[model samples]
Target chain A: MLILVTGGSGSGKSEYAENTAVRLAKEEDLPLYYIAAMKPCGEEGRRRVERHWRLRAGKGFETRERYVDLKGLALPKRGVVLLECLSNLTANEMFEPEGAGDRTVEGVLAGVRSLAEKTAHLVVVTNDIFSDGMTYDEVTTLYQERLGRINRELAGAFDQVTEVVCGIPIQLKVKGSSVI
Target chain B: MILVIGGAFQGKKEYVKKQFALAEEDFADGAVCGEEELYWARAVLHFHEYVRRCLETGESPEELTALTDRLIRENPDVILLCNELGSGVVPVDAFDRSWRETTGRLCCRLAGEAVRVCRVVCGIGTVIKG
Candidate 1:
């Protein structure tokens, strides 16, 4: 099964997704894996990563750092995998010298498919970044377009799509149900 | 307390007015209201701007959220209208980044305490919490 979780910053979506992944892992007796997307940087960046680490401190998740080119990576065993987010991954693929560049959408999606095939369940976290109502520079706007496309595509493919608002999960799509 | 949030011009204030039966006079515009006014107002609008103003005046994000916590405790029935600012591309300016992050953190805190929470999109209100 594939799950897609999205929300604005600090909306508690991470905690919600983490708990979901942990439950699924326990239910199926599968090893838990967490894919950390953001590359840690300066003092503030490091602090942010540390904060997330603290949140998952005892969750029994083995962390994997895949900055870009996810399709090339492989897991050691079949288990439930939680990708922390898509926003950072999109940014990395768009700007990172070694990223997929213009091929980000297909590249990331292909990577997702590959990962899903290898894991018992894949839970992907993304950002709800289109509703802020702002116009940006050309490059930033292009990034938004690309990320937006990625989110739409994944939501279509995933079994469950949820948007967390103020720590509340609003189901936008549920598998086999078109009325939600 | 009640929280009404959405993107700019999403009719959040109008929703509050119609749904809650509140008059315009009951709202304390966060853009220009005195800090003291926030504690007693029946409702508040442009809350993101209020967060920006506080940051501009040297108030740290922690201080702003703390102040809001106190406001929630003291005025438990107050209705808050805030823009959902953190859903867009991260800003290039340092201040813009801090402002959005602070506003988001504050909203999370407010939503936790609010008796009702509604998100407005395309002028339609979805009750996410109550």
Candidate 2:
């Protein structure tokens, strides 16, 4: 099953996604995996990553750092995988030296699709950065556009899509509800 | 207590006015209202701005918690409208980061005490809790 969990920063989406991964892993006895996409750039970035580590310290997830080219990452088949975010991944693909650059949409979609095929329960966490209503530079706007398309496409393909607000889950889609 | 939240320009004020039948004068503007005005206001708009001002005055997180506690104790029926500010990219400035996190935490606390919590999107309110 593919589940998309999205929310604003500090909206508790990370914690929610972690707990969900743990639950699914325990219930199905699957190996829990955490794919960290954010490249810890500065002090703040490192601190944020450490905070997440502390939150899931004893959750039994085997961590994998994949900054770009996610389609090549190797994982055990049928394991429970939690991708902490798509925002950072999208940026990495757009600007990183070895990232997809202009082909970010296809690159990211292919990576995610590959992960879904390899995992038993895939819980993907993404950001809700589009609603801020701030104008940005051309490159930043392109990044937003690309990420927005990625989110919409994945939401349609995934089994469930949830938007967490103030730490509460607002289900935007559910399994087999595509017809509705 | 009631909590209403959404992104900026999402018509939160209009929804509150229509839903609660509150007039313009019944609301306190958090952006410029005196701090004391919160204690007795019927409803507050831009509550996130109020939080920013509190932080700007060096109000510690603990003190802010106490102030909100007093708000609940003094006026349980007050309604709050806070923009969902944490959805954007993490700000580069230190103050901006803390401000965003602090507002989010405060809203979480308020949501817990609130008897009703509604999230607005495009001027429509969806009750997430009651």
Candidate 3:
């Protein structure tokens, strides 16, 4: 099963995803895996990683640091896996040394596709960072455009989709309904 | 005035455009332009930015409140679009806190006077007022 959760900065979507994955793991009697996409290059990044570490400290999640190439991740054949975020993954894929030359929007989507196919239950968290209604430079605009398209695609491809606002989760897609 | 709000990239602009037939020229961004020029806009998309500017310029929220009143009085069909209530943890910075608080208050004031209010989620609009 593929679950997509999205929210803006400071939203509790990350915490929500973690808890949801934990619950799914327990319910399905599967091991929980935390896929950390961030490279933690700066102080803020490191602090964020530590904060997340503490959040899932006792939640039984084995962390896998994959800053790029989701397709290369080797997860156990079947288990609950939370791709902690998609934004960082996109940035890394777009600019990281490994993907710099060959990566495209569809390529990133394909990477996520592989992760979904390889996992028993895939819960992905993504950031909805662009709708500030402010125009940006060409590069930022391109990034936002790619992410927006990817988000729409993910929402359609997943079994469930949700958007978290101010710590509240609004179910955008649910099983057996075409509402989202 | 009509208030339409949704999360980032939730198709709020597209919804407004398709629903109200508001062309790009018809809708003005609040992030740019001066205070007086805002009143001249047919529709002010992202009303929060105007409020942000008001706060930044050391203008009182009351001044914004009055301005919204004048805008509504001048243009009976004006529309406002704001990101729905801050749906995340409170900001740590004093300026951010004030901005969020002031934006919330401004949205409420505008909504209070709005003829219709709608919350859009996932391209779906739910009428909260009117």
Candidate 4:
């Protein structure tokens, strides 16, 4: 199953995804695999990610920080896999002028699609940047635009699409409905 | 939707807590709300932790939306405290600019979800949305 979880920052999208994945893993006895796409830039950044990981995984599950080569992870064919985010990973890997290159958004979307096709159950987390606001700068405008496109594309492919608002899950797409 | 917004280190946090306490007192005769402070701390941690996680995992927007929805569901009468990160000059670095923009977007989204929104300035609360 491919699940797409999206929301703005501080909207509780990460916690909700983590909780959902953890619950599913516990109930189904499936091995949970977390694919972290963020790169730790500094001491503060590293500590913050560690704290979130501990809070979500509770100190047991393994975590792999892979930003660029997302397709190489192989993501075990039988368990649950969570791509915590795609936008940041793409941003970090394809930084600056490179990110502005063609196929950046498409490449990320294709990666996500391939992962979903290969995995057993996948929970993909992302941000919903469209309803938030307009981007103020060039780089941000590019990122936001690309992210919005990626989100729309992934929403089309995923089995379940949920938006986390104020820490609550509003299911946007179920088995067969378009409105979430 | 009591929106409590201000810049960093402002008194919005304290004011929100007081308002929460006052509301509790008015409604339930001082019945203590256990999760107010906890939520505030969570909010503070949530901001940085979320950014860090996003940087690490490449997750999407759903995580944030789900979190906010859950919080609102749990406490409809929530007093959200948000930093006004966009009311200043744009940053020179890409990372700094993105951080500011992301936080500003999140705060705006939260205010929209709020039934009542207030901007706290100089320790005084002003309603911005209702």
Candidate 5:
């Protein structure tokens, strides 16, 4: 199953996703994978995220820290994969002056689709940018446009789509439910 | 206020500091590594802290809103710096993905508030606003 969690800033989307993933692992007895998308630049970034790991899983969760293409990590067959946020991943892909040429919308869609097919369960967290407001500048406008497109594609692929408001999870889509 | 948006390693912070003649004492700089000492270091560090705070508190929009309000209130020819993290391939992992999103939002928010905005590519600051 693929799940997408989205919300504005301070809405506790990350915490909600983390808690949900933890529950799935502890109660469901499934393997858990937590992938951090932030590039560990210096000592502080690394240490801060390390603290986050200790706090969340108590050193039990298998954590993979990286700043490159994420396809390298193989998803376990019978476990849960939680992608904390989509905004950062998309930004990383879209801002490369040169490498971005290799990444097309079609290619990203294909990858996400394949991942959904391969993973037993996948959860994705993203910021709801539209709710925040709009931008007038070109760079920002371009970023928002691209993010919207990516979000739409992910929403279509995921089996469950939820938006968090004030730390509350509001399910927008579910399997076999057309009310979304 | 001038908002500088560019990719990592681009001298957006340094350029802004030079333009404003802002000294180390005028602003506080926080980075992923620690508190930066130089103007450039502080600038990059500020962006890093912005991202970190958003991630840790899950309060990116609110923090940005407050910052924007503060900048407007201060109105001291502010120059805010940010990394344009959305110009590459989509990250497959959650953490990297979150950073990309947060950075993108930061740039957007800053650009919206900036009287002038520029995107530095190849050491060239191309005007994207004003």
Candidate 6:
């Protein structure tokens, strides 16, 4: 089961998703995994990552810093995994790595599928990109288009989709077959 | 004054029209904007485009921000429609990033003075302030 949560910057979706992951872990007594998508940078980057670390701290989660090839990573069996964010992951997968040539929508979707197959309950938190209402240069436009496509695909495959705005979670899609 | 906001093509305009009983003639498309154009309009749509246009005319975001702040303040009966741009990922280009920042600042200014603020998502309006 996968739960997709999305919102704009500072919209409080991360907090909501984190709390949801914690709750799910408690209910099922499954080991919790936090898949950190961002690579740690210098002072500024450390500060941002620290904030997220502090949020998940003491929540019984083991942090796994994985940026690409989610299926390649060795995840715990029957554990609940929360991927911190999909935006940075997408950017990393699309831009970084030697011979990263696979920036297409199919590439990201494949990774997500692999993670889903490995985890018992997956809670994925992502960002909403198209709401800005501005068409950008070719590269940025491609990034936005790919992110939008990834989001729609996740919503279609996942049992639940929620958009958080102003700290309020608006349930957008529930397939009725969801247990979490 | 009230401010209605939403993502692109999320029905913010239609919702505002139905709720306020406003017709097509009541709105002055803000893209061809001027002090004269907004003088007596019942409401304004595409105000974001207006800001973008203002930027093209060599005006700074701060200048437009001040201008819009005054416009919303003086026109108590006017209901403004704006797209909430700050909630998305920051743009990569210098120009687009500046536009996004400017629009966010302008919306913040309008939201500060407006009596009501409603966000429309999936055609559902949630009143965040009033």
lDDT of 2 at B78: 97
Kept native contacts, fraction for each prediction: 0.64, 0.54, 0.00, 0.02, 0.00, 0.28
Tens digits of per-residue lDDT, candidate 6, A81-110, equal 899788888888788763134555776778
Give the alpha-carbon lDDT of every model. Answer: 0.89, 0.90, 0.77, 0.63, 0.61, 0.78
Q: Mind giving the per-residue lDDT tens digits that candidate 2 earns over A142-172?
A: 8888999999999999999998888778889
Worst 10 residues of 1 chain A by lDDT: A171-180
Instruction: Report the lDDT tens digits of candidate 5 across residue range B1-130.
Output: 6667655777765666666676765554545433223222323335645666556667554565575466555554656666655444344556666666555555555555667776666667767567
Q: Write the per-residue lDDT of candidate 4 for residues A67-147, one digit (tens) a residue.
A: 765655575446777887866766754684534356678678767777777766789898755443435678777776777
> What docking grade does candidate 6 earn?
incorrect
Flag regions of model 2 displaced more than 4 Å.
B60-66, B89-92
What docking class should model 1 receive?
medium
What are the candidates' individual DockQ scores?
0.63, 0.61, 0.05, 0.08, 0.03, 0.18
- C-alpha lDDT (0 to 100) for residue A82 of candidate 4: 80
TM-score, every prediction: 0.93, 0.89, 0.62, 0.59, 0.52, 0.65
Interface RMSD computed for candidate 1 is what? 1.4
Which regions in candidate 1 have their CA more than 4 angstroms from the true location? A178-180
lDDT of 2 at A135: 83
Model 5, range A1-180, lDDT digits (tens) per residue? 678888764345676788777776776778887766665556745864675666576634576643335554566556777775566666656665522433635444554565566666778887766632334467666767777887888888677888654334668898766543
Error of 6 at B89 (Å): 3.4
Candidate 6, residue A107: Cα displacement in angstroms equals 2.6
TM-score of 5: 0.52
Please give, for residues A129-171, the per-residue lDDT of candidate 3 as tens digits. 6655566677766777777788889888888998765455678
Score residue A124 of candidate 4 by CA lDDT.
89
Answer with 1 or 4, whichever has the higher TM-score.
1
Winner on lDDT between 4 and 5 is 4
Error of 3 at B33 (Å): 27
